[model samples]
Target: MKGKNIRLLRYAVQYWFLLFCIYIGYRFYLFVRHFETGGVSPFVSRPPSVEGFLPIAGFMSFKYFVLTGIIEPIHPAALFLFMAAVAVSLFFKKGFCGWICPVGTVSQSLWMAGERITGRNFRLPRWVDIPLRAVKYLAMGFFLVMIGLIIRTSMMVLFFITDYYKIVDVRTMKFFTEMSTATAVFLVVVGLMSIFYKNVWCRYLCPYGALLELVSKLSPARIRRNKKACINCGSCSKHCPALIDVQHSESVSSAECFGCLTCVSYCKGEGALQMTVKIPKKGIRSVRPVFYVVALLIVFYSFVFVAKVTNHWASGVSYQEYMKLLSKQGPTQREHPRLP
Candidate 1:
């Protein structure tokens, strides 16, 4: 029974991880299709009145949405994804990290490649690893200060409602359509970095992942390690994609733990680790030194962000004038202005 349970859990993780890659890959393919063909991507359908792809609608993922265009408020799909992430974490204890994150998938792919090329494995020293982990927190804080407060109130409003909409004019489209050499080089650099480091970007950078980790810590679903059940074999930690020391902690550290089922799958004994929901003691919640700093930074920078946005100094340009400008230049009425 235990063996069957473990197998089932592993399969579930594999399926979700696969699905995540397919979804993101599909999105990328769509972008490339449009970029190459000068026609709408297959993934995006346009109504008769709409000459090209339909206006980007749905989802309030600031990370992707903002990068693509001015962020619309949280869409149902983005909210659904968020809720789904929470639900999965609650029930499966970070299965999302194990199964859903494309970045994690990429990291694992690189690790496999490294193993194939070099007979040795990669491992960072504790001294370098500990401080490097702080990078994500700092990046998250920067976003919170820049977007959540400052831009949302001041600059973001103008962009989302106006200026940003215009910035993606025909000229801008042409520029991106002919992606600059610099942008191409940047992408190559990112790809190379992934091959060399275990999750170079995701580990020390991704603000979105940092935010999710913060919420996951509050999630009832957590990995519970039963120290009494087993030998001190370090298989669990060895397999951990996020490099968490699951063998030592009763409750896996939320900040570092991706809720990947690697530790659970690798554990030799049955019931050594299980996902469960339970509240921590009041003081236990703030026990980690990093937690306090994260909390303080979020609070402090949120105000700064708000002040900057209200000051009307944000970078996004307006939508209507952008359209007029494009219309004046040519008959490219089909092009829609995108947000920065």
Candidate 2:
């Protein structure tokens, strides 16, 4: 008999989280509106969850924290959120991508809609697919070089202290509210492409996902196959959103595995596929989907709760600072004093 499938439960969790994210976005909009209107509107305090959208800023905060042993005051919530993501990857192997990320949820929804309409999603030939998948890694490499290498230590400190960094959240808010023609077109194209291909942006262009994949290589929890009980069936591979060939491998160690457990859910053969940990000489240990889900939530929210208790969840910038910065009309007017 097949094990109890958790795919529906996973969907429930994804949609629940997505709804919470949408609420955060709306709350943030009101907060920014209060500033943009010069306090004419009723004030809504900014939600710390808005920092989740600032991944690039979070990356900087993470590096600065590592080097200086301080979480920078500008976007401290970003650092906490970033650390939570890394922790999830360390223990659960990109479970954040599968369970929590709004972008991933959107991508999954688009592809599922496509499958419903067209009967199935399509895969590229290996020659084309292999190169396309490298695009995310290449993008990750570019950021690593730009932030990790080229930007010197003193410059990073100065950059964080600048007025521009102080109001980056406002700038980000404007970017989405005032989307340009080019950005609109790019999103449209990506959306349409996702109809035919599974997770087009995630599979080929998400630098964040790429970084998680690298970190998750060290994760102990993995999908293991029982060859002794195996009937050669390709169900696992067929259901895999990441296109991993789970049937052929003794252990699913691929960086592409997002820990969705679609493979484990689909396998009907007894003891054929399971999410488990295998230590040398210690033997294999099975892990349930619910356990992974609970673990991920605990790690992520625990960090957030600690940050709140420590008063690091909110930005240090004051309301007066936000008014002075956002009063400027456009990007050109809001340029940092230090920028050329």
Candidate 3:
């Protein structure tokens, strides 16, 4: 019973988000399919939620907004989604990863399937694990250098208005639909690795996860352990997905902690591990899991609502423009006039 709440909550969130993502994907597919067939098929309005996949574009749009004080006409929803994710991490310690991300859900499912087949999960040696974890941070550094520092405002605006950027969402859809052999093999390898290890892609290769980790360090709420209540058992440590040593620590402040509350839920001793907000010189106050969930939902929806009200939620590109761009047989063939 002690561990039941976390499992239930985690599964509930994961499946709910996963289904929502599938619906968004289906809608986007129908929208693109109409153009792929030269508009002969029935039209379906494009779902703005599909722009959630365009994070790099989101960064560019955000930078453009900072520079020009205007939301870019293309992929405006991406910027809103990006902001919501960052806000969730800043306030709730990477709760977006544990509670909302579809990739995280799939990774967890793969590892759970592996456990059922093999009877347990396996961990890499400390030497191998430490270096592998560094990969994500290195990837994040590369993107920061490329997008954050090197790309200037003029360059961003130029890129934003390009045909390539304009049709990027279409290309992304095609990539999955017409997956090449190399891409298929790569995905298969990653999926296989995930089955053997917990969150293999997220722990080792996800630059997005690394970015969230950095933001989550600023979060006030954290997993707090009351050593006085602990009974010297290692159940929390054993169950932790991030591999943090929960029994020994007074508080789990590691950036790797996803705030899944698995550690808190697994603690057999009463009042042993809990989520708490640290106040300056005033000690700490416990934060219920339900409160964390509520806060995350409110922050995410509020930003979306604001975007809608400000006329920044929809793409300025019209269905006619998509039809013209996608009427070509292949992604490479689809081209628009370059901004000189």
lDDT values for all models? 0.51, 0.85, 0.85
Ranking by TM-score: 3, 2, 1
TM-score of each: 0.61, 0.93, 0.93
Q: What is the C-alpha RMSD of each candidate to the true structure, in Å?
A: 10.6, 4.9, 4.1
Candidate 3 C-alpha lDDT tens digits along 201-290: 889999999999999999998998898899979999987878789899999989988888888888888989899988889888898877
Model 1 gets an lDDT of 0.51
Error of 1 at 269 (Å): 1.8
Better by lDDT, candidate 2 or 1:
2
The segments of candidate 2 whose C-alpha lies over 4 angstroms from its true place after superposition are: 1-5, 279-281, 328-340
- Candidate 1, residue 268: lDDT: 84
Please estimate how well model 2 matches the true structure, expressed as its whole-model Cα lDDT: 0.85
Which residue pairs show backbone clashes in model 2?
none
**Model 1, 194-262: lDDT tens per residue?**
665566666776666676677666665566787888687888877676777788888785666765555
